[model samples]
Target: MKILHLETSSRNCSVSISEGKTLLSTCEEISESLNQSEKLHRFVEWALEGASLTLRDLDVISLGKGPGSYTGLRIGASAAKGFCFGLELPLVASESIATLAHPFLGKEYDVVIPLIDARRMEVYTAAYDGATGKVLEPTTNKILSENTFEKYQGKKILFVGDGAKKAQELLVQQDSTFLSEVYPSSRYLVDPAVERITLQQFEDVAYFEPFYLKDFHGVKKTK
Candidate 1:
């Protein structure tokens, strides 16, 4: 199956095309100036063009439904919905945390935490059991603090996401493995998206929406 994946849940905007287990193409840009609205379609076009395929040729459209930037999520969802509607393809809504956790799947660790920046020292986070690859109940609202990971002390935790950098200093003393370098990308969504498509796990294109953990709060006006 040919899958086109879109990710715009963080600072980076990315798109990828994959056929079964083989990645055909991927494009990414990390500039804040080039976010979902500005670069998402371009990236998609580039990825498809590079792979010598068109949107109509895709079997499914998948996206990173987020707990990241509200604007970015909206843009991604809008684009995914548009493509799904236009091409009559199934829509797969993959969670941003799951995308962040994609790279570490199959690795053995006590716990895996995928965090996305929620601004003002808060993060949208969820815990996953590395051994079973299952998300734990009650996704968290993690506030950055000096001893944030104290509760998980003695357990080896691997942290990955955009918020990992900020959490690194606070979690320094804990028995933690920081994967601050990993960024959310469409490549991470492809395999899971493909699996979902194969299993017919899809969302209603007309009503599916990105999972924005909270309402958007832009910079306040200064009078």
Candidate 2:
């Protein structure tokens, strides 16, 4: 089952090709400018070319449905839908936060909290069980503070993703580890996407939309 994955919910523009749980290739760029709109197509082509496959060779399209950047998620969804439509393939999607935590799950930490910088002092995040990769806290846009993860204090927690840097300073936990360099990547979507495909949990390509928990709010006009 050759799959093409697109994850563009954060600053990173990521694309990958996978065969079931095995990753074949990835093309990613972490730009502060959030230029995913400019790089998504090229990344997709790069991933496919690197994997020595073409659009027609893909069996499914998996995407990072988001609670991150609205524009970035839209860019990724458009590209995924275009590919799925063009190739007549099925679409599988995963939460952007979960995708960021996938690679770190079941590692050393007892809990994993994946965070996406939501500008200012707020972050889009969720807590996952490190051992079983289960959600401990549902996705939310949290305003950072020393008491952010108050309930999970004293546990060995691993905070990951772009917003982890913000969390490191504010989330007061002596046992916490922070990996701020991590970002949601298409490669991590492989296993969950494959499982969804196996269970026929595919999205309706024609009507699918990114999981934006909130509406976009652009800069207000100043007169």
Candidate 3:
């Protein structure tokens, strides 16, 4: 199956082209000020060209549905939905946090956690079984505290994602480990998206929305 994956859940924006389990091409950029609507399509074209393919060649369009930036998630969802709608293609949605932690799948660990900054010491996170990528602890918004993750203290837990640094500081004095380099990428969506495709788990393109764990509150201006 030929798949095109899009990830714009955070400052790191990325896209990937994959055929079954093999990644054909991937591109990413980390820029806080980027206009996602403009750059996302550009990266999409770049990935397709690099893979020697075109939009019509894609079988499925996958997206990193987020608990990250509000604007980023909207941009990604809009683009993916547009493509699916326009091309009459199926759309698959993968959890943004799961995509961030997916690289650690099958690793030697009791659990894996992916964190996304929720601002002001809070984060959107979930725990997954490292070997099978099963959800060990369901998704939730957690407020950082010194005693966090106490339930998994005796087990080896690998923490990852853009929000891992903030979460790590709170768990550092405990038996937790952190992976600083991990960030959400479209390439990580290939396996899960493919699995969904095999199961015929396509989303309703018109009604799908990014998993925004919390309502977005715009900053107030004070002059």
Candidate 4:
């Protein structure tokens, strides 16, 4: 199952070449800003070149479908669909929060919550069972409050991703652990994407769109 995964849902713009769960190569850049339209193709080419493969050799094109940046998600979706259309390959789409949680699938924590910073106080999040990676709670946008996630108070809840930083003040008082360093990346897209590919759960390249949970709002330029 040779796959090319694109992740542009966050500041970390990444591309990964993988064969099933084994990652062959990855090209990533983490900065304060991301311009996927400008860098996506180059990163993909770099990853493919390093792996000594081309788009034609891939069995599927995977995309990190998101509840992250609107522009970033659009860019990634366009590229994924284009590659699938051109190469006549399948498309496997995985959520950004799920990809963020993939690396913690078998950890000791009872519950794992992956969050992507949406703005000042809100985050896009979903809860998953740590051992099995099963969704205990589906993804949604949440605004932090003092009692947020209090229902799981005594249990070991692991909070991860870029959004965790902003919620730290409140969550720190609860029975929660924070992993502020975890960010979205194509490398983490391998496991879930492989499962989708094996199940033949391919997306319609012609009509597929990323999960942009909210409407995009562009800032009005002021002089």
Rank by TM-score (best first): 2, 4, 3, 1
Could you estimate the TM-score for every candidate?
0.89, 0.95, 0.93, 0.94
CA shift of 20, model 1, Å:
2.7
**Where does the lowest 10-residue lDDT sum fall in candidate 4?**
167-176
| Model 3: residue 91 alpha-carbon error in angstroms | 0.7
Query: Of the candidates numbered 1 and 2, which has the greater TM-score value?
Result: 2
Residues 157-223 of candidate 2: C-alpha lDDT, one tens digit per residue: 9998889897887777989889999888888888889889999999998899888887788888999
Candidate no. 3 TM-score: 0.93
lDDT of each: 0.82, 0.89, 0.88, 0.88
Candidate 2: where are CA atoms >4 Å away?
Answer: none
Question: Which digits, one per residue and each the tens of the lDDT, describe model 4 over residues 12-95?
Answer: 899999988999999999877677788999999999999999878998899999989998998999889888888998898998
Candidate with more favorable, higher lDDT: 1 or 2: 2
- TM-score-wise, the better of 1 and 3 is 3
Worst 10 residues of 3 by lDDT: 172-181
Models ranked on lDDT: 2, 4, 3, 1
Model 3 spans with C-alpha error above 4 angstroms: none
